[model samples]
Target chain A: MQNENLYKELLRRFRLKVTLTRLHVLDVLANTPVALSHADITEQLAEYDIDKVTLYRTLNAFTKCGLAHKVATEDRNWLYALHMPDDAPSEVTSDHAHFVCDECERIYCLPMETGNNTRDIKEEQGFVIRSQEYRLHGTCPECHTQFSQQ
Target chain B: MQNENLYKELLRRFRLKVTLTRLHVLDVLANTPVALSHADITEQLAEYDIDKVTLYRTLNAFTKCGLAHKVATEDRNWLYALHMPDDAPSEVTSDHAHFVCDECERIYCLPMETGNNTRDIKEEQGFVIRSQEYRLHGTCPECHTQFSQQ
Candidate 1:
């Protein structure tokens, strides 16, 4: 998708207005296949005239409104990506596993059957429960073979 | 276990000296049957001389040494708790689900069947992955019946 279309579509899907900063942040994630952490995104936008506070706010907003979701990394820093799917609601794609390579630090979203569902669980507290994310860590096929060869 | 026992055992487990603060933090978690966020732990430890940074460091230390594990809460804020026996290291107990009450706002960890191991998924990207934590969100049995009656 083009940068303009992605930004506009994200705005509509999340029911939030798209500022230039938000668009830039979204564009970065949409353009990359791997998940990017807060620091990663900021470093990438170092030349885009984006402020640190604004970047934080934009990423937080993206998470809250479902435009994006938080991805956990081995280093404990929070990572995020463009979560807007084409046909299904975000929940379908949102409840999936994450694959991190053992060689490189890149993170990829892997959708597999994990028998991981929570629709049957009910809220015991008063806080409205919204959504959840799952992550699976392992060596990718290439990395697995690479490590085996060495 | 008594506060003293919990403290001493944790120190032995982590190969660290038992400090007054670490003891107090463990007491709070021991008393707290469910997983707690950093804010929750700090508020509980307000009567002590513990600093927020210290509590974070202590928790991180505890987590790294396997005395505790960080659990995912519905809120983005990370939650921590002692690793229970059901959560043995062999299988993936991290895939267990959590219940956040829409009424009381308390988060409860609920155990479910084991989720699929992701070792079979095709690799994407070269990011190195060292571990995986999976969490599901939903309501508890108590709240489920309560909602049905209402």
Candidate 2:
């Protein structure tokens, strides 16, 4: 999608105001394969006229309103990615499992065939659960095959 | 286990050399109900003479050798907890699902009945996965009941 359309749609979906900073941050996350940390997002926006405090505030805002999702890696760095609407599960978003490639050190969002519907489990366990995030660490397919060949 | 026993066993389990700093850090995590951040650990060890850099280094060493587990909350701070042996499922380790109480902001590690065996999924998906961590966010039973009563 074009930057302008994506910005407008994200603003509408998240009930956030159409500020340039918010839109720019959203754009960076949308294009990233792996979730980016706050420092990472800042590094990417080094050319832009934004400060650390503002970036932190904007990211917090995106998270509070559900425009973005957060994932933590082994380093315990909180990485941010664009979140999909709770009602909609597509190729992206929180519905899928996260796979990190050990060899390449890249992260992939493995799309799920179905939404992580845990109603039955929650009912059985009697948990008033609201959300779930699953993270997997491993070698990617290429690395697997390469290692097997060696 | 007593503090001394825990410290000794932790060093042995993780093949780590025993030091007063390491023992003190492990002692702090053993007493904490949830994973703690570097700052939190520092605060807990205020009576001790450990410096901030040493605290950070000790936490990293503990995590690297599998003596403890690190988790990041929404605030982007790293929290530490002792990791259990793979054969034993415990309340403090990575052998369970993490549930964060939304109202109180307290984190709970619920013991999982079965290990999340992902070999089949990895085979079907053709990815060589190393590990997985599951996280859930919602109200704990106490909070749930209290909120419902209102």
Candidate 3:
């Protein structure tokens, strides 16, 4: 499929070796709208019987090459998502903040809004900010409804 | 000391049993300007010969009772800090964002700034937000300076 080809091209672009595990991981990340932890990815790729160390190494390579980024969750799990280019609009990108449902431990990508820029902080605090992550912890709509019903 | 009494008072208010281990942990958290992981806290309390399980339990109790808040870091370590009341100004509170230095992996508490409120996101997204944590990743002043010099 075109996505598979694109994943291959991305791997080549990032100078990463083209491996089946990397491609599979990319496919999983691309299809997932929200970031997923390593465990989630492993579950999704269960049919492949991918080696755990291989999968971890593949993810690390992707992260180091800017192909993906990881978000830290409250449970100390790092959720991995693709890093889409600025021109590409993707739900999993770091362009916006993420909402984590405290009750269910699910992560959702929230839309980006204005007036939350970190440039001022960088200037004032003298920090060389390479990246930033904004995470909101709360009850999602489904969990809110469930709690209300309870 | 006056601070010791305050720690005891806090433990009493939170209904946590007053113990030497708890007191030491609170003292460590209270004195630290930046958040610390369990390992960091353990290192700080090495002289006390505290049990790992007991330390973890005490931390969990403190976190459950809202005496402390944990911020997830890049390495999947949860950095623990005190959750000061709104009237109290503390460097470790969630009132502001946190900055983690990628080079040194040191976490610093940034001052709260205007125009970064999450109320609008909550209204638009329909999430029942209990608390929010904003994290910025970059190089700290020392690391930046070192990198620049290098």
Candidate 4:
């Protein structure tokens, strides 16, 4: 999907009031494959003159509305990514595994097999396990090769 | 382990000189079963007269030395629990499952299996995956029963 239409559709589907800053934020995230931290977005969108609070609120709303998913990094801030809306029918969540690059500090969502039974986990405590986010940390292929070269 | 002994051992094991503030911080974390955020420790140890910066540094050292493990929570603050030294020499570091209680906001380490293979996961990425932390979140059995009764 083109930039303008993606944001327009996102706003319509999420019932979010469309705004330039929000669209720009969405656009930046949509184009990227790996998840991004708030610092990443702030630096990336610094040219746009967007307010920090607006960015926070926009990301928070997108996360709540199933337009994006949050990956918790070691540094204790959320790394988020565009969760393609049309992939899974039920809801948008980060059930997929993640890879946090130790050197570059990038987080990527590694897709896993779907229909994984979580009942064994839930039955143990009568606990409702709603969603799962699994992360596997390592150097990315690019970083791994660079480290070996050095 | 008692407070005084634990504090002294922490200093010796981590190769830091024994200090009043570090001891207090260590005591607070060790006494509590729940994984504590820095903010949580600060609030609880307010009377101990420790500097926040010192506390953060101490935590970083402890994490590096394998004296503690960081548990990921939704709040985006690094939460830590003391890694109790195990009797088994082979299993020094914590490879156990951790449970985060929804009602109590406590993180409990449940004794269970660990070191699940990632060789298959690596096949998908052609990347050498390193360590992983798996945390399960839910109401504890106690809370589950209480909620059901109500």
**Highest-TM-score candidate:** 3
Candidate 3 TM-score restricted to chain A: 0.80
Preferred candidate (lDDT higher): 2 or 3: 3
Superposed by TM-score, candidate 3 places the C-alpha of residue A48 at a distance from the truth, in angstroms, of 1.5
lDDT for each of the candidates? 0.66, 0.70, 0.77, 0.72
lDDT of 3 by residue, A1-150 (tens): 349998887888777888888888999999867789889999999999998898888888778777787777877788887886555333332445788887888887655555776656575768877656677777888888888999
lDDT of 4 by residue, A49-116 (tens): 88889899999988888888887778777988877656432365335567777778888776643443
Cα lDDT tens digits, model 2, A9-118, are: 76876667887787788888888777788888898888886888998898877877767766666565767777756464332223446777768766666544333334
- Candidate numbers, best TM-score first, in rank order: 3, 4, 2, 1
For all the candidates, what are their Cα RMSDs to the real structure? 4.8, 4.7, 3.8, 3.4
Off by over 4 Å in 1: A1-3, A6-22, A72-76, A88-94, A101-105, A112-132, A141-150, B1-3, B51-54, B72-76, B84-105, B110-112, B115-119, B122-131, B141-150
User: Candidate 2, B123: how far from true, in Å?
Assistant: 4.4
Q: Pick the candidate with the highest DockQ.
A: 3
Q: Better model by TM-score, 2 or 3?
A: 3
- Evaluate fnat for each of the predicted models and list the values in order: 0.34, 0.65, 0.79, 0.45
**Order of all candidates by DockQ, from best down to worst?**
3, 2, 4, 1
DockQ of each: 0.35, 0.45, 0.63, 0.43
Q: Identify the superior model by DockQ, candidate 2 or candidate 3.
A: 3
Residue pairs clashing in model 2 are B36-B80
lDDT of 4 by residue, B1-150 (tens): 266885797578667778877788788888876789889999998887678898889888777777777877877678888776663212223344566677877777655444344435564665656655555666777787889999
Query: What are the per-residue Cα lDDT tens digits for candidate 2 across B61-87?
Result: 887877777777866677777776654
Could you tell me how far off, in angstroms, the CA of residue A61 lies in candidate 4 after the best superposition? 1.6
lDDT of 1 by residue, B44-126 (tens): 88878588889999988777766666764444567887664433333332444555554555666555434444433332344
List residue ranges in candidate 2 displaced over 4 A: A1-3, A19-24, A38-57, A86-96, A111-127, A142-150, B1-3, B86-96, B112-119, B145-150
